[model samples]
Target chain A: MLKLDREIRDAIVAHAKRDHPDEACGIVAGPEGSDTAARLVEMVNAAGSPTFYEFDSTELLRLYREMDDNDEEPVVVYHSHTATEAYPSRTDTDLAQEPNAHYVLVSTREHGNSAGPVEFRSYRIVDGVVTEEDVTIQE
Target chain B: MAIEVRIPTILRTYTDGQKSVEASGSTLQQIVDDLEANHSGIKERLVEDSGELRRFVNVYVNDEDVRFTGGLETELSDGDQVVILPAVAGGC
Candidate 1:
């Protein structure tokens, strides 16, 4: 199961809402070997398309270097699907390289940018296989 | 010339779980060839059949993306750092 703080969950939802038409992507980093998701680093969607999301290459490098210096690793890698369910698409499963990270998919299809519930789900995608996992929101 | 290549987690299997390894070459392609010689089977993961860098893999030579720096032909010097990362990308 992926345990996330309530505030972090809310922030992810808000980010998805804010980028309604375009996909939003980011990562939550924590100390190496620590599964706790403590630092939320929002990434720019270089694709800037509703159906696609890609972190800018340069920014990606910097992010990795910073994480290296801090001895942190991405605990949760997240993205939003504006018109689809909170699930991993074929593309998502194929491109998932972080086998250790919990892939979070937040779907804003139901409410768009409005104030309503969105589907926030987590999964583990490894070696082209995606397994949906339970999420426990911690207050 | 010795170049330090930082391997990403996903590719550690090719490096015997080593995070960084030393390679020698004057260009990116030569460096990849040297890596393949030592690691065996790693070149296929980074290079496609068409002799181009794989789409999902990003290679950097000293902070500049190899794609912007003449791709596999990017010149390298001794003490240069190379970082390989899988691009964070997906589409619905």
Candidate 2:
């Protein structure tokens, strides 16, 4: 099971809403432990539409280096689906290079309404297979 | 009944901009054949001529990965969702 803190979930939702009509992408960094609470590190707008997301690996390398400097490692990678559900896209499954990393997705479709809860899902992509896991968001 | 195959955006260029298509088959291979019959070259994009899935592509049935199940032989029932996902590279 994967768990997220309230602040992290809110940060992801905020990023998704900020990039509405397009995709938003980011990574999560934290300690390497089961009890470690992940936090959203860097957020960016995906350069393309829902069909594609171009995360600048150069920026990622910088962030990775920064995390290294901070003594933290990226533990999760996340992105948002603007008009789609919080399900892993085919592109997401194929590009999942970090098997040990948790893949998180947030759906911001039903925005602005009280019932429009942000949908968050986590997955582990290994060898071209995406395995869904139960995600617990701590309040 | 035929199952519905949902195509993602990247591969839609090959399917003439079709986002979702319907095909008849019980197994994943049969569905691929049906897709090829209609789209002509979709099979080549999803699978190699040697009958192996492309390294950059992934097929999922109802959110469960076909690779972990039976791969091309994975049985399909009505309303099963087949998602073809390719690797996405980009970000900074």
Going through the candidates in order, their DockQ values are 0.90, 0.08
* Highest-DockQ candidate: 1
- Per-residue alpha-carbon lDDT of candidate 2 for residues B1-92, written as tens digits (9 for 90 to 100): 48888775456766887868898899999999999998887898789888987755667787665778888999998878787755434221
Looking at model 2, the pairs that clash are: A54-B90, A54-B91, A55-B90, A55-B91, A55-B92, A56-B91, A56-B92, A90-B85
Worst lDDT run of 10 residues, candidate 2 chain A, spans A56-65
Give the per-residue lDDT digits (tens) of candidate 1, residues B9-58. Answer: 99999999999999999999999999999999999999999999999999
As a TM-score, model 1 comes out at 0.99
Q: A1-139 in candidate 1: lDDT tens per residue?
A: 9999999999999999999989999999999998999999999999999999999999999999999999999999999999999999999999999989999999999999899999999999999999999999999
